[model samples]
Target chain A: MEFRGGWDRCCGEARSCRMLNLGHGGVRRLSTVDFPQTTEDLSLLYKYFAANQAALTRNMKKNKQLLEEIHVDLDIQEHLKMQEGARRFQQVGLFCILLFVGSAAFGLYGNGVVSKKHLTKDEINIHFERFFRFQAKMGLQIQATNDRDISISFPIQYLNHFEISSIVPEPTETRVEGSQVKYAFKGRDELTATFYLVPQQIGQIKGSVNVNENTFSISHFIFP
Target chain B: MNPVLRGIAVYLFVYVIFRILGKRSLAEITTFDFVLLLIISETTTNALVGEDFSLTVCFIMVCTLVGVDYIFSVLKTKSIWFQVASEGAPLVLVDDGKPLLKRMQQSKVDEEDVMEAARLTQGLRHMTEIKYAVLERDGSISIIPKEKK
Candidate 1:
């Protein structure tokens, strides 16, 4: 019987080839012009080959599914690794901030910028004007000094500049002692003043003295 | 008073005084708030820890301050006229993605500062992306992003 399908033609010579080279490479040429004696026999053989092809296709689909599953697992692991890296980064940042704040607090508390010493005459003269300026800037009241001998003087215009809220001179003395020339004149303003003091100490002397409305510091000492 | 006790007193005074003033976020603290903080700290330090440490005196001072703050808060919350007098309302800096020129002048807030805040906090790169900007009570600008049509 002649088979019309291409599969019958291709498999016509498969029987002869299977007998000779079934285990080796061989092409099977099926004869479409002459074949099995009945159509029923051809149909049975076709059905058997079709069933095998269907089984092969199903196996291919299963293999594809396995490959996809492996890819998905790898993706999940990569995502978890990224999240772990971010967590570590946040922890390190927090640690750095705490360290910075702690060091700053320690530095502010432990460091002392001011020293204690007696004030010198020349040093006092130089820092007197600066002290006045500081007082004017901060608007702080300069109370009376403890010593009565230290003469205080300033410019006349300075008084008008500061509105002399209150004046509490030390010792309530009309005239300061120890100076032969106890002349007190207000320079340009009441706020600005020049006072002369006799040298009383030697070596490096440092001390703070209060003027009208401000405190003045004297550094360094020179002996005559 | 002891140093520890003095510190606790000062801390409590500061907390109560600030709470009475109003609830303002850190970002919203104004120049006035900064000045108040500095003055309060200086005053409290002298009153609490100095040689003349007196609990009665400190309490009296703190109570007076809280009283003043309460008056301001009550006025601001109840009457519109008093609110305008005490704590000014939020000013509209930008409306519908456009700068309010007149409002800016009345508010006394610099345009550059508002723009900088919007850009830094709200991620606003361009003026068009900002739908509205309001300067809140705490001296911070609240920006609303424009929706794409």
Candidate 2:
């Protein structure tokens, strides 16, 4: 008579099953009773697991030793180190290249390979912005035609080392404030002034001029 | 307008720019980075030379740059502070099979980088097998494998 059942039941019915490898070297055979059902079985399984772990550790050591004998890892390490060293050397080389190019540029540009930007009176007037410096000569130019007395006033605190070098038309009168200077001149078609000044300290300097009924202000920066 | 003076100024400016960009910038390179660097050099070249092309000016500029570079190298060797400031110290990314996440993040290093180093150096298959991973000064990783029991 032939009997049919689930795989585990059929295997259990066999006297000595050869259908599966139950453990290493096939020392054990597959059986439904292998499943732990009692404390004793559970303890036996735990021992099996611990033995397997120890065997795995031993095999890993052997594998490591074999790898060391071939020196494959060391060769790879050396090659990688060489590549890293080459890359680092390349970076230094790039820095040197930059320095070379920069130095060459300095040599050429400083000697006048390029011309300085020169602004026209109209350009300067159109972009009438305050200039900046630590110490510099400041030139002011104005145009007026109305027949009347006009005066220009500026803060004296902007200049630490101050001097008034030249004025196109001498002022009719001058006044001094605690931190300001006022110069009165007869309104003419054109006027110019050159001032030698040094900044008191590092900050923005604001100066204003009042002539007739118009007031104008300028601002600048001083380097530390 | 002296070439030597110009050379000094350009050197200082370039050094500061690179320093500001940070150290990792030198380790990795991209195509756009190459193009941008070329453009920067072209622009700064004109500002550096202005209009001068004299042989004497060229020679002096070269000499001054070399002298300054030599002085910096000497200083770096002599002073620990300068060395630390210019070239950063080596960092440890992994200790005893565990990754130091913060140091790795700060240095732009990662687990994959350490793993790669381990694989290359000791044929390690997993991060758990590594005992230590050091990020060297030149931006390379050095890995030490766990001792076999």
Candidate 3:
């Protein structure tokens, strides 16, 4: 028997195929010249995919119950395959949900990134997002055991990338020492500095942050 | 902040969140769901457009979002696994007039939700009237009546 459907010929026979219009622009073929005499004919002739646009959505159940004894293996096989895939996706989705929550909590992109470092009875901490869009604001703080003198140095590359927006408890002296700039705050025990950085370049930007006699490295990957 | 990057990040983040939330998120939304969606969009606008109120900046943002979506669509068509990965597979929620309680509870769908769709679409009165109820990948409940008219 010849089929009239759209596009590709599913029966693989050389005949004029035009679809009866099922769903998703697929061609559904029906033979009116000869009624479906066998179960095979019925299986190939009658198959429908109903799209649900309800407020409450659910998965497509393979409803072979319409022709129970006939057992049309048409939509069921594909839907069942999809059903299996749908079932498996939940597990993958759950894992990704945990990952998303974890990423945000750790402050990779969303929030919560305040890292602290200590050296020589003095400690410095910065509130920074590990992964941030280019030109995002970040802050730096330093607490010293002795309030005698604190000199925070930033490398020339760091200076080039980040525009220092503001410095709180203004530094007594600011000078370019060697390859880095030193901002000295005399006798200031606790100091906080803010950088309203407009990134001139993207990708991994890493540099040494020298605080007084000690040095530590800070690195950040900026996204475009 | 980079508007294009911001747009891509927001799109991917929202897509993943909705995927985890389930098909109901993409379905014909309820009143509260639509409200929440509006709030989310409003909040996202600031992050996406930022202080750069220029037209070109907003254009770049829109381009980035649309470009990412088109790329995903291409991938979905090219790869079956990608199709399933991006847009999840359809699931069968009911069989032979019996509600699959485990799957229903897991998906946060109750009998009433199914009945609501059935009533609206198939004019179905009761659970017994439904031959099969399938939850489509796009957050739609496709119901098949036991007695087809």
Please report the candidate that would top DockQ against the real structure: 3
> What TM-score does prediction 2 earn?
0.43
TM-score of each: 0.32, 0.43, 0.63
User: Judged by TM-score relative to the true structure, which candidate is superior, 1 or 3?
Assistant: 3
Q: Lowest summed-lDDT stretch of 10 residues in model 2 chain B? A: B19-28
lDDT of 3 at A111: 34
Winner on DockQ (1 vs 3) = 3
* Tens digit per residue, CA lDDT, model 3, B64-115: 9999999999999999777876676655666645676656765567898899
Error of 1 at A43 (Å): 89
Estimate, for each residue in A1-224, the C-alpha lDDT of model 2 and write its tens digit. 11123214212233332222232212222234455555665556446645754675587476532111111123222222233333454467668778857854643222222211222332122112243333334445554445566666666654333345466567888898667677788765554433434444446666654544455665555432
TM-score comparison, 2 vs 3, better candidate: 3
Chain A superposition TM-score per model: 0.20, 0.38, 0.51
- Candidate 3 chain B lDDT trough over 10 residues, lowest sum: B89-98
Q: In what order do the candidates fall by lDDT, top score first?
A: 3, 2, 1
Local accuracy by lDDT, each model: 0.44, 0.55, 0.64
- DockQ score of each predicted structure, in the order shown: 0.02, 0.08, 0.10
Q: Which stretches of candidate 2 lie over 4 Å from their true place?
A: A1-126, A131-224, B116-125, B146-149
Where is the poorest 10-residue window by lDDT in model 1 chain A? A66-75
**What's model 2's lDDT at A193?**
37
